[model samples]
Target chain A: MEFINDLMQYEFLQKAFFTSIMVGIISGVIGSFIILRGMALMGDAISHAVLPGVAISFMLGINYFYGAVLMGVLAAVAIGVVTQHSRIKNDSSIGIVFTAFFALGIIFISKAQTATDLTQILFGNVLSVRTSDMWITLVIGGIVLLTVVLFYKELLVSSFDETMAQAYGLPTRAIHYLVMVLLTLVTVASLQTVGVVLVVAMLITPASTAYLLTNKLWIMILLSALIGAFSSVVGLYFSFVYNLSSGAVIVLVATFLFVLAFIFAPKQGVLWRSIRARKSKSAA
Target chain B: MTGTVSVKNLHVSYHGKEVVKNISFEFNSHKLIGIIGPNGAGKSTLMKAVLNLIPKDKGKISFAGDSVEQVRKNIAYVPQRSDIDWDFPITVIDTVLIGRYPKLGLFRRPKKSDKAFAYKCLKQVNMEEFADRQIAELSGGQQQRVFLARALAQEAEYFFLDEPFVGIDVASEKTIISILKKLRDSGKTVFVVHHDLTKVVSYFDELILINKQLIGAGPTQEVIKPEVMNKAYNIDFDLLNQMGVGV
Candidate 1:
């Protein structure tokens, strides 16, 4: 009891816990849309693409979040433009741009004299989150959540049928760009809590698991956010006790939830549907 | 119902090659017009040009004595089923709701009344039961019905359908034809880009035949004579007769 109380008293641990919860909520909400749009790999690509931006920002003594968000949005626009204007497939464009940027980031990091711990960028240490980063995460997450709710109907229409949305004069191009911007914001906000490597997992897994359980978009969003928050808290607790990386543990917990949802979700899940089909066939 | 569509000296190209030569036509409301042509004859291009879905090299199209942008609300278009991604994660209900988007305008949600109207349109097409089902799970025929239901929800005075009956079951084809006829009867102009010649005589009130240019157009029975069919299709009538599409 005294040890648990003592752990709670530490400022860094409390800051990390609060930051992880905020990151989880934000990633969960935005990630639901990302998963629905099948942009999971794109999210991963953006995370990697932001590394060069971060390295350059660090060298220039600038705020890394701004640099990350800027480059993330640029990467998204490049992918969108390349896929739409060129004959190349979208995944190929993503792979090309992300790998190239990531390679440049690695070069920049290796050449730097300061030699900041590379693991801090690759796999985040949640215990190191400063109060400023926590505040930034909360503010950005709040803005993203508000924007999503405000443009819910428009986003839903455009995501479901972009051509039809354009035919009806819905400004689908603007919506497409807006979605990319929002995705960049979510990716940057998640950097401190989950690191660049595992952030995409948080953005994709919870929503995908929720998708298997519900057909309603609103319900899916709510469920994803809840699942994400639950995973963050549990993962944080487990890591505190067992001395594991919190970000990786959180992602693993989310993945486990996804596996469970895949197997056991009522109507759309694999196991339940198979069993129901067998039972009906035998009855017939 | 009194609107007239006029296309003057329209020329269209795809990838720098002129596909639809100088063509002109005037169509009025309440008429069921069929655009017929052989494969690669630019019938679809002309229709798209009229809708402003494609850019014309040279032309002026006026709808109801106004430009397309000025009178956009009066037109509704149904694209070919193949043009859409069927794997899109949307329900039949949401698909029909998109038709109401143009009517709802910006920053406005589909209200209770709009949703009720959408349900009524679905019921008209006998697709009310599948409202919540994912569009990808539906068969080709059901998909066509859903698109038709969306058109019905649009409530436009002018409608365009591109090969709506392609790959659909006979019953679905009959249902679509009946619905289109009802639209015509109610004084809404409808243009159908159709391929089947056998049903042209009975299905359309008027026909416009095309082969890179306007061939002939008039009442179906008059426009479908051997000479006109040959000019539009670029095939001898005897050859079509041999293939069992009687002249």
Candidate 2:
């Protein structure tokens, strides 16, 4: 009770709460499409691939956010180009590009003139998110949400059934790139909270949990956003009371919810499925 | 129902080897056509090329004397059922509502009238009750019915279905055939990639028999002859005789 009252008193805690929730919502919304399209790993790749851009941007005395977003988008484009031009396939292409960019980021960090904190960039310090960073997250989150609303039908049709989208002349290639761009934006937005190593978790877990619970895309999306926001707010509370890493706490909370859904989701859950199976067998 | 599809020297190649080699045929609307062949005989390749879904190495495909791009809106394709992710989280109505996407263009949401039209299509296929159901939960035949409803909602003049009968219940098959027949009767063009030989005469008005190339194409009775069968499929002589193809 005291913790709840104190949470409102600390401005940093307030910033942490708002930023984490927004990140969760953005990631969870785009994450639904990411998981459904089987691009969860691609999301991971883009997140990791942005590291080099961040380091280079720091070296250039510019906002690392721009550099990180640019690199993320470039990595997406490069992955597409590699898969299209080579027989290595998509997963392999993602592996190659991300590792390469990540290595370059590490090297850039080591060679940088400034004292770069790898841990901070990798795991994020959500409690320390500046007001400017909060504004960045807010603007980007609003843009992503708006774009998703405007193209909800296209994304749903394209991600659910690419062949049908192509047949409908829906500009599926453009839709593919649009998804990549949205993913990049979400990753950039999430960098302050979950960082690169775990942003994919935020993008995948809540959406996947909702997926196990609902059949309708809109419901799934809504449920995912709710779960995301819930986890962030709760996780931030725990982080403050327990003095733990805020980013890790947020991701752990998302995963915790996923585990709950995996084991307890109605009709589709593992425990229910087994229980039903046992009942049918005994009756037989 | 208002155009013709003409393919001239259509060819599709992958990795420098031709999958569909030198195929040419033309057909007008208001007919039900079947493309049949043995596995790996480019039956899908040919159909996709006609719609320019696949890159054509050497060909000209035109619809109603215009390029395929200009008339693509009139053509709707129902891909093979197995090709889709059935586990996708979408209701049947929304699945059918995708048919309105082309008409809705890039930025618009599906209007309420679009939902009503989708509901009507679901009713046509006897799947309105399952409109809110997840596609994954439906049986194979029901899933096929949903795809058909989606195609129907497109309101296209020419419909191309890939293996619509594969893995479907008898009732659904009958419903699909009757729908195709009705569409044909109403002067729309319906092209189905089918494998069942016994019902060709009853199901399709014309046939495009292929084995990596165009072997024969004409009215079912004329195209299903033994000479064409020999070219299209290396089946037993007795089976050909049973099929009543004249040797």
Candidate 3:
């Protein structure tokens, strides 16, 4: 009750609340594509690779959004180039590039020693979210959602069968790079709420939970967004009431929902499968 | 809508090793053409290169008198069943509906007529009952039928299928072959990458024999001779005799 009362009274809390929910919703939306393409590790790599850009922006006295997106895209291209040109697989290339960027970021942060708590960039403090950050999140969220709605058919076909899409002259490579750019924008938008380290959790957990619950892509996306938003609300309340890290609490809530779905989803749940198996055995 | 696909000196390589070596063949429209080769032969590579799915080292693939780009929308391809992730979260109808994407282009959704056409394609394959079911719940034959239905839904002038008969049930193979024959009879060109030499005489009107090179390409009777089989397979020609391939 007090948390709700404080939310109504406080402006910063309102910004934080709204921003986190937007982050949650957008994360779920883009995460659906990421997981479906089997690019979960790419999400992780891009999120971590953004740290160097964040640090550079801080040192240069500019917003990290521009730097973060630039570095994320560059890292994605680098990973692609490496995997394509060599015998090394995609996961290895992602590991090499993201770690190099992350190490550079750590060195820059320690050397520059900015007045702001840089720790917040690593582990988010949603309570201190600015008005500008909130607006940026909302705008990015709108663009990401709108893009998905407009290109639903292309994304579905290209992701499902690359050769077929190519035969149809769909420019599958361009579609892949488009998704990569959207991922970069999403990662940048998520920084204020979940930060760099936990952003992938926000991205994948709700989507995975939704995956277990539904067999349709649109339904999974819808359920994922709802789960993500619900987690944000509950996570924010708990973090506000108790002096806890908002990012950590939000990730935990999303994970808990995944656990519930994993055990109880009607068609896919392990428990239900076991019961169905036993029934069939007895009947036989 | 009938057209010919002519390959002029087509050469494709992978990882600096040539998979298809200086091969060339012209496939006529209004016929069922089979690409026959050994296990490691470049039948699939040839199809992919012709479709521009993979990079060709050197080649000219022309549909009718136009380049591939000019006639891309009129071409439809179904890759091997093993190439797909069957567990992907998609309904049979939605999978079939993807065939309309080229016509719909960007920024446009499928209209009611498109859906009806997709359903008709599924009906042609006798898979209309499984329209709403998830793709993973299907048997191998049913899955092949679904893919064939998707290709049918494209309504293209040219169709390329990679091993559509491999690992499928007899009923599905019959259904798919009959559909292909019907399409061919309607003056649409159909190319299938087939491995079973036993069915070569019965399934295809024309055959392209290859083992990294074009051994022969003509009517089934002329191309499936003992000498051409020896050149492509390097196997005992007696096996062809035993299989009653009309060699």
Candidate 2's residue-wise lDDT over A85-135, tens digit each?
Answer: 877889999999999999999999777756548887898878888898898
Q: Per-residue lDDT tens digits of candidate 3, residues B132-208? A: 99999999999999999999889899999999998989999999999999999999999999999888898999999
Per-residue alpha-carbon lDDT of candidate 3 for residues A1-284, written as tens digits (9 for 90 to 100): 88888999999999999998888898998898888899999999999999888888888889878889989999999999999999898899999999998898888878767865568888888898998888988998999999999998888888789899989889899999999999999999888878889989988999999988887889988999999998988888888899789999999999999999899989888899999999999999
TM-score, per-candidate, Cα-based: 0.88, 0.97, 0.98
DockQ of each: 0.35, 0.77, 0.84
Off by over 4 Å in 3: B239-247
Better of 1 and 2 by DockQ: 2
Among residues 3 or more apart in sequence or in different chains, the pairs in candidate 1 whose N, CA or C atoms overlap within 3 Å are none
- Candidate 2 at residue B26, lDDT? 84
**TM-score winner among the candidates?**
3
DockQ preference between candidates 2 and 3, better one:
3
Please state the error at residue A12 of candidate 1 in Å: 2.6
Q: Write the per-residue lDDT of candidate 1 for residues A1-284, one digit (tens) a residue.
A: 64467467988778778888878887888888887777889989999889877887788887788888888888888888888777789999999888888898888877654444667788876778889888888888889988988888888867765655555557777887788888888877777767889989999999888888877777888899988888987787777778788889999999999999999998778999999999999999
User: Of the candidates numbered 1 and 3, which has the greater DockQ value?
Assistant: 3
**Model 2 off-target regions past 4 Å?**
B236-239, B242-247
- Expressed as tens digits, the lDDT of each residue in B118-175 for candidate 1 is 9999998888999999887888988999999998998988888888878999888888
True-vs-predicted CA distance for residue A270, candidate 1, Å: 1.7
